[model samples]
Target: MHELAIAQSIVALAEQQAQNRHAAAIEEVELEIGVLAGVDVKALDFAMKSSVKGTLMENARIVRHDIAGEGRCGDCANVFPVNRLFENCPACGSYAVNILKGKELRMKSIVMATIGLQP
Candidate 1:
């Protein structure tokens, strides 16, 4: 699955950030995944767990936030919740719907333990 690739990318990003900050280890990683992002959450989670092995995030806590899909009707100017893409507007029954959210797959934040000089 492509989720494995995505998970690897996430790990690579976290590793890069940790290296940039001179971190000793990564403590936590927060991810924001939208419902319409076309990713399998369960698969991504599994892939993430596998990808982090022997890495800085091996012991890190992974947090995921599920974002709901929202769309705005172009014809009626009505906003409504959307479960899938290309959905017709609920209020006007028009097919001109513009997506307002729920297409995100991003790393929101990372917590790292920096290497400190011992006295």
Candidate 2:
């Protein structure tokens, strides 16, 4: 599924970041997934396990943050939250609405283990 590809890409990016910082291992991965992104959180978690098998993030914990979709009405200029995808604005009941947020699939942050030994 598409989620698998996204998971693979996330793992690749995390590995690259870990290498750049000379990290020994990846501890956690924080992701911000928008409601309109159409990503299955459970599927992503499973995909991460398979994708990071040979990478530095093999044991990393995938942390997902779900963001609600938001849009601004072009007619009334009102901003409101949306749970489903559609063209109509909830505030003004206008079809001319612009999406302000959501529909985003991105890795927000990463918690990495130090390269050197720790007590």
TM-score of each: 0.96, 0.90
Per-candidate Cα lDDT values, in order, are: 0.95, 0.88
Q: lDDT (0-100) at residue 58 of candidate 2?
A: 88
lDDT of 1 by residue, 1-119 (tens): 89999999999999999999999999999999999999999999999989999999999999999999999999889999999988899898999998999999999999999878677
In terms of TM-score, how similar is model 2 to the real structure? 0.90
User: What is the per-residue lDDT of model 2 for residues 1-118, given as tens digits with 9 covering 90 to 100?
Assistant: 9989998899889999999999999999999999888898889888888998988998888888998899888899988887777868766689887888889899999999976775
lDDT value for candidate 1? Answer: 0.95
Candidate 2 lDDT score relative to the true structure: 0.88
Minimum summed lDDT over a 10-residue window in model 1 is located at 110-119
Give stretches of model 1 more than 4 Å off: 117-119
For model 2, state the Cα shift of residue 94 in Å.
Answer: 1.1
Instruction: Indicate which candidate wins on lDDT.
Output: 1
Candidate 2 weakest lDDT stretch, 10 residues: 83-92
Native-to-model Cα distance after best TM-score fit, residue 75 in candidate 1, in Å = 0.5
